[model samples]
Target: MGEVKAIKGADWKLEIGGLTELMGEKEGPALLFDRIQDYPPGFRILTNVFRTQKRAALSLRLDPNLSGIDLLNGWRMKLRTFKPVPVSVVEGGPLFENSMSDGEIDLERFPAPIWHEMDGGRYLGTGCCVITRDPESGRVNVGTYRCMIQGKNKVSVKVNKGKGGRIAMEKYHQAGQPCPVAISLGQEPSLFLASMSPLSPEINEYEYAGWLQGAPFPVVPGPLTGLPLPATAEIVLEGEIPPLESKDLPKEGPFGEWYGYFADTTVGEVPLMVVKKVYYRNDPIILGVPPLKPPNHYVSVPLGAAALWDQLEQAGIPDVKGVWGFVYSAQTGPFTVIAIRQRYAGHSKQALLVASGARAGAYGGKFMVVVDDDVDITNPYDVIWAMSTRCNVREGVDLVKGVWTSPAEPAIPPASRSPRGYTMDRVLIDACRPYQWLDEFPQVNVFPKEYKRDLEKKWKL
Candidate 1:
């Protein structure tokens, strides 16, 4: 934002908004805005924090100059060997300077923005991470979910039924125990990345972030909630979620979702968090990352690719070259591509089935393409061409019915949806050239590499 201001000055808003419309208009940069309106000055808000692959490179401690697929591939490569560092819990930090308790735990003191005009309400926890622990296993979990400001000292958090955080809290609820929770408003960027990631239960984000940053992710136990809180966080809301059965629960969003749709749901009751304590520093900044259309997913997309790649490789799927999760047009695009070298009659289908059904391609992908190794799956154009030229729709296309999917997918016919949650009809397109006659397939035209290399060397091109 500072760099943008230095260049655009008075016209920064137009530049920022235009550039953030998609992941990359031209050499996309990760953007963070303190605030668009002056309603709440100095209560810093973060938007499009990791809007592009180039901007996301910084999380891997890589050069910011790297852009596009190179940046995505770089992070995925590093994550293959990435090891998380354990967190060192400290006693306290700036988060404790101004404490709120008793009757002062109001949500209205800070300036929360109505980010987009169509938003349902002012959201406080857009970029905030919710922390919870399993009552039985004591395993900790942190995740990013929508929080709508409902009343003073009260907010509603969307608890997706299958989400790890929800599962952890549900364990407490089923055991008739109050779930201890904390919302860290702003912390290190790496921490936010981890919270947005789908990490296994044994791997806490603190350690994962520590490895990404090449240092320990410092944390402290909250005084009230006792769950780990970022030591240098701008603000921390320590609270508890009381177990509620379907009667008279809190109402959350008609808000815009990351899928570029307003989430109007039938189940009006989602989990509510009653703020018990509020801790903050002087002039603290709240990282506000709401569900913008074509949502910025720096950590989710690339990391998810790496995880999926590893899954396919470990499953003995042969000659898998790469994977890329398209994050545009969806919160972690339901579109994914896999590059593989066919080895047998059913090899391509096997790769597709293993990946689409695996954890990496969860939430029922809308369109998954299995491209031949020649296709650069990272490039959208190349993937499209492969789909058009290489695929024989009647012969190559297939569907997997009754798969778990997000409730927000527009493709699911209205009559099929109900209170039981969503099931998807996933489409898989074998975009690879038919392997049966590889020897007879036409080859692609290209300039000779050595000729171009020699010319460039002499001309300094």
Candidate 2:
């Protein structure tokens, strides 16, 4: 955000769709107006924090031009050795420059933007991280979940089933207890990155943030919840998620998701957190990151790609070259691509099965394509070309059903949907040449080096 600001950031006009509604639909890096209207000026809004891979890399202190696999691989390597530095408590940082506690909690007074036109309500936790604790292990969990304001001190939240935050909350439900939680906004980018990362269960995201920035992720305890929070955060809301019956739960969405579509207005009745305490800097900034569509994968793709690639390698899938959950699907769903140098008859299939069956690919996965090393998984055109010529639909396609997916899948039969989970069909396209034809595959058409050089000199085309 500072980098973009230094370059005199561009203005993004708000119209019928609302201030942040059209942000996800844009294609390139344009750090636009975060706080446009329906809010005060002292409180700012930081939008498009991770809209492009270039900005993402620069925000993480990587080369400004670093992108795709290079950017992802660099972070993946650092993630392997995340020795999390314990959060240190201090008087407080910028986060506690002001205060709102006890009966002072006021949701409407905050500059929370109503992003999309079709959203159920104003969302406050779009770019924030929710902190909770495991009932059994007491391990701290930080997750990014959609939070919608209900009343003055109330907000509803829904988390994906397989998420660590959900798991922690479920543990509380099992014990018949309310879960304590803290949601932080306008915090350090490293903290947000770690919260969104697909890290191993054993690794805490705080440590992951430390590894990302080569320093500890400074934090202080929430006054009400005692959960750690980014010390320099712009605002903090501490509350408890009380386990409630269906009739007592709160409705959360109808908001635009990362997939650019609104499948279900509400995931289900979710627990509402009653804010008991609030802390903020003098003129707080609300970190707004509303999910809209494709270009939004600046967060999902690079990290998701590297995490899936690492998992495949750990599973002993040899000859693997690259993997990506294309931005077209927000890094989830059927568009996952894996590039491999097929070494044997069924080597490619083995890679396919592991990738499809793994937790990462288990949800919203529709089409998983296995391409040869010569094809670039990052390039959709390259992947499509390989699919066109190297694969025969009848012989190369493999179908796998009963694969787990989010209930938000629009194509799922409504009768088959359940609050527990849902299943999506998956197809593997073996976009590689026939392994039997070892020596006789047709060579790709290309100009010879001298001919290309001469053509380059003679024509600007």
Candidate 3:
């Protein structure tokens, strides 16, 4: 189902990363690299696991034939049925086929790639899951945070402020205790998806993964940290993050982000984890999901838009047909589009306003557009055509300032950014025809969909 190739360690990073970028451009198959320049024959790395709709659907246990907004809408309905499926604790599994402790630890034994030329160091945890528990409620949270190797037994984790893992770690540190952590380098695809989802703090990711897969996820207690580790994981690292001042923490990141830019690198800003134990299968496969530039995303479908659609409906905007995003991240990013069937004079504008500020569409957002239901929101051409024909420049666009955004946004001036948080302006566009003049508006020159389908059937074209 994918390509397997051998690579030399001297030029491994560049070759692998270059190949991944090229394949992403063309929507290519998964890549499996083995026989490294210095590593054993069976040691390997896998990438592009969810780059195709078929693969993404299969990973989430959904029907593979679904595509576009239909697929996302299916997931949205599934989300409504979510219930916590507690994980199963197994005593042992393939994850413990081999083990290493303090004196024998050497992270370099496994190949960590420099996915981008500008990356400050080798990142071993791009696709990995960082597991932490809240000290106050004992609630476990699994998140996908970048981890870069600093030493044989140390990896600095970039847990951004306001993330569940970061909040949990800060709580432990405030109590003068070390925050226990477990890093799973590779595991079932459902687990990885749940780790990166925008789940609420009260929901445990392990349970969410179980719900996604329709079965209880199996995990084992870490030998040292007692944190849950994926029983079938390829590699697992047990560690703890102790309270330390900014000066004492190691430098972390200038890595390429999903937003298609290298975020600012900081010195002594990230938290450092001291690994105490390592467990792995006989021949581990590291899941490498390095962020590529815009138009080449890690996940093919606009999954985030599904949540936004749900929020728009909940906000009381009626006749919502679909939602799609372009150049997106975990949530919506630079451009988000909403399709709705106009029911009243102000229906379209109401959707534009609510979607631009809704919890699911607000973060990392730049442009928000609302189009009529007839336009294919997933197609850029269709969306742009609606804007050109229906919207009056003077009446359609509104800019909202000081909106919520991430620090990775390159548009934010360095002088304007504060250690506290980041914000940016969002432009909301109404592309639907003016409902006030509904009966007087010009009709689109196009064949009806049902009539076109009938012609296609009769002509056999």
| TM-scores for all predictions | 0.89, 0.90, 0.95
For model 1, the superposed segments whose C-alpha errors exceed 4 Å read 1-41, 264-267, 295-301, 328-332, 448-461
Of the candidates shown, which would achieve the greatest TM-score relative to the real structure? 3
Candidates' lDDT values, in order?
A: 0.72, 0.74, 0.87
lDDT of 2 by residue, 1-461 (tens): 33343112222222423434444355334333434455455666666667777677766777767777778777667667657776666667888888887678888777665676677777778888888988789899888877888999999877767779989998998888989999987788888887876666888888777767777778887777778888888888988988887777666677777666765555346668888888889878777777666645436344676777888999999978888776433234558889899888888778888999886666678888998888877788899999999987888899998888765666788788676767888898888887888468898886667898888889965
**Better structure of 1 and 3 per lDDT:** 3
> What TM-score does candidate 3 get on C-alpha atoms?
0.95
Query: Alpha-carbon error at 71 in model 1, in Å?
Result: 2.7
Candidate 3 lDDT at 347 equals 93
- Per-residue lDDT tens digits for candidate 1, residues 1-461, read 33221111211223333444443333254444543443344554545556555456665678778765566667667777878798988888878889999598778677665544555666777778899988878888888887777788878887676778888988888889878899888888888878877677789888888888888988889888789899899988898988877665755556666666776454456787889999998778777565555434423345667667778888999998888866532222578898998889889889888877776676646677899887878788999999988898998999987777776676677788665567776688999888898788888787777989999999999
Instruction: Give the Å shift of residue 192 in candidate 2.
Output: 0.7
Quality of model 2 by C-alpha lDDT: 0.74
Model 2 lDDT, residue 2, Cα: 38
Question: Positional deviation of 415 in candidate 2, in angstroms?
Answer: 1.5
Query: Candidate 1: how large is its RMSD?
Result: 3.4
Worst 10 residues of 3 by lDDT: 2-11
